[model samples]
Target: MMELGPKPRRRTPTVWVGPVPIGSDHPVVVQSMTNTDTADAEATAAQVIELARAGSEVVRITVNREEAAAAVPRIVERVRAAGYATPLVGDFHYNGHVLLTRYPECARALDKYRINPGNVGARQKDRNFAQIIEVALKYEKPVRIGVNWGSLDQDLLTELMDANARRPDPRSAREVLLEAMVESALRSARFAEELGMPHDRIILSAKVSEVQDLIAVYRTLAARCDYPLHLGLTEAGMGMKGIVASTAGLAVLLQEGIGDTIRISLTPTPGGDRAEEVRVAQQILQSLGLRTFLPQVSSCPGCGRTTSTFFQEMARDVQAYIQRRLPEWRRRYPGVETLKVAVMGCVVNGPGESRHADIGISLPGTFEEPTAPVFIDGEKYTTLRGDDIVPRFLQILEDYVARRFGRDGDGKRAAAPAGREAAAPTRRGEEDAGGVAAGSAARSEAGRPGRPAAGTPAGSAGGRAAGT
Candidate 1:
């Protein structure tokens, strides 16, 4: 596994959510919760399917009341019948113990149960928590011991605060809260283990609204225990602020290899797509090189040198095209998600960026040539000009996909091209000499005197001479 930062992964016991693995050596799982009313089985089921289609490995729905709990089996049935085996999780709070007990079917239907350690009860904390664990044991399902900073166990928090007060140097309230959050999760997991739940059957989460607190608590928890940690920043507010904060927090921990599974708790805009949360999670993983869900297109931001919006327009169109074709590609070409395409605005960095991609195009800008060069595997193949640029470039992209990922007789995709060495310009030049532009300079030797190679520092080479 790739280590993104200094800290090594906190190796933990593995847990399975249906056929999907969580914990040691597994791909970090992406999960999201449905915002629909859980008691409305149809709405919940539809949202679950939409989330699954959008790449959520696990889908959670709130099961607060008896009505919601009762609807679990039907929701599961509807989702499963629609052809997705995505594991459905129940998010239970204060009334979880009672609902799981009174509605045995609900307990049996869910693949996993998420219990909040804080809201169970103050006086009967142990009893209520244990009751939920027992139901998990009875149903043979794994449990996620989720402890939020906002609803932290008051008893535990008070005890920690009192102990701090007696110290010569009391810790900050945020520090105390962090400690309490970690303690609540570890203690709850231990409680479940004591009640006959195996270590591998327990997952833990300690979420806080503050990004720093969320990262600190999880770091502490990862050091203390080997349970699979579910990472998230709780109650992240609406819009870009929420996306940025959640991404920053999750990225910190994830880069440190601290989380096993993750959820982005974004408050969606009114009537907006719920699938946006799932897409954000996928994007984070992809950007980190941890996972790939679709083909990646590297496009440059337009600038002063690029007088026309053609390159930016082409980039957006290409991205949309890839997204639309991804589903069919996945079914037909198993490894196509790894494909890299670049659409660069101006000649400066365009060719170098194009050279690095599986397929690329360098569009002309300003007073330069009107031609656009198409690149395949680090070599310039052809120059496109005028109204044919978009459609022809698209055609080249389609042919490249076919040549690289066409299916065999058994209907499985052919093996991917070996490596960068396999895509050496010499081989491609020999294969398609007619298409190769005569005297086209290779990427390594293309740099002009006193100028860095195109795309070397990324968008920096934008306004330079074409093919330099």
Candidate 2:
């Protein structure tokens, strides 16, 4: 990836969720919550591993009932036994104090405890909140005092509202509500500190669903607290709306350096992939130039000048190619995630954009040539044509990845020089740690998501029952 200038981060005290660090000094963390019933440890642990493999640095599961609490140890055990270091966070509400106390092993198994002050028992709110804090203190685990709009503490809102009502110039009800959300998190955090929880052991989040409200609430919270913050637009719906709303809301706060970690709350369809949330969160960070998790494909939306069918098909094929190769590529190529590949549909801006990417392919536009020009390091390496375009291009891509990012014979990683072509490198079979040859690897991958039409074509969990 080209250097997209990084924004100055907001400074905060660091909080660790297992081995991952959350603070301005650390890269913004990507996290996702599971929709699986926590009582089913096997299913939940499987999804946890899936989310972690998909790039969730931390995975949170709802621990709403005794069964769920009882399964915590097993879930943690399974996740660790599978060789994933991804931190597991237990989301608690209502009977959290009881669950944490009765199930000491569960409390100890979790990397962190998420407390929703809104539903921690209104009558015994402070007492119950203190109990969980004590458990966290005992286990030396971090706590996220996560506040959501739907679950803002009514007592705090009413208190703030009544106080505002008495003032000569009262604030709007919405303003008071947002204020209450912030207060709920901050007040709980302060009370936890008073109860012996270290200041650094606490994380704060005041989340609202609306993009504008989320921005306003977080801007205020960021100003008032020095604790690391978990950022998200709670209940961001499903599909395109969810993705856009989350990206919009998060991008703003992230650009301002407000969030320490992020989770995308997308309602997955039944039997849908829960790992989608993790991928989205990673993309948000990658898109903002804050972090790089996978190679990004830049493809133009087909215009009148482009052959819609062929062009669109190539774009989809290219993206699918990158995704399929990611697992192996990541293991073999240390910095391969920073690779940028562009699949342009036409000549107008295609070559220009292709030249800017680490590797790119400019497919001929309508009435142009029958060939696709492939670029590597800003130079035209070759022009691909015939039915072999996809395979050939993928071959070039894998070779570049192996040569530029893969380790050499001595096992030290090699890098392509900036602004110039690099010396001829050992072929993929020679240098690859896995010893997989470039030709065979590309052929296998291209065969899986093979492109048809030689010419052209086209192509989180959160919320109230528990804390997000």
Model 2 C-alpha lDDT per residue in residues 117-165, reported as the tens digit of each score? 9999879999999999989989989999999889888888889999999
* lDDT (10s digit) by residue, model 1, range 407-456: 75342322322211211111221211111111111122134443335323
Q: What stretches of model 1 exceed 4 Å from their correct place?
A: 1-8, 409-468
- Model 2 residue 60 CA deviation (Å) reads 0.6
Off by over 4 Å in 2: 1-6, 409-468
Instruction: Quantify all predictions' global Cα lDDT against the true fold.
Output: 0.77, 0.78
- TM-score for predicted model 1 compared with the true structure: 0.86
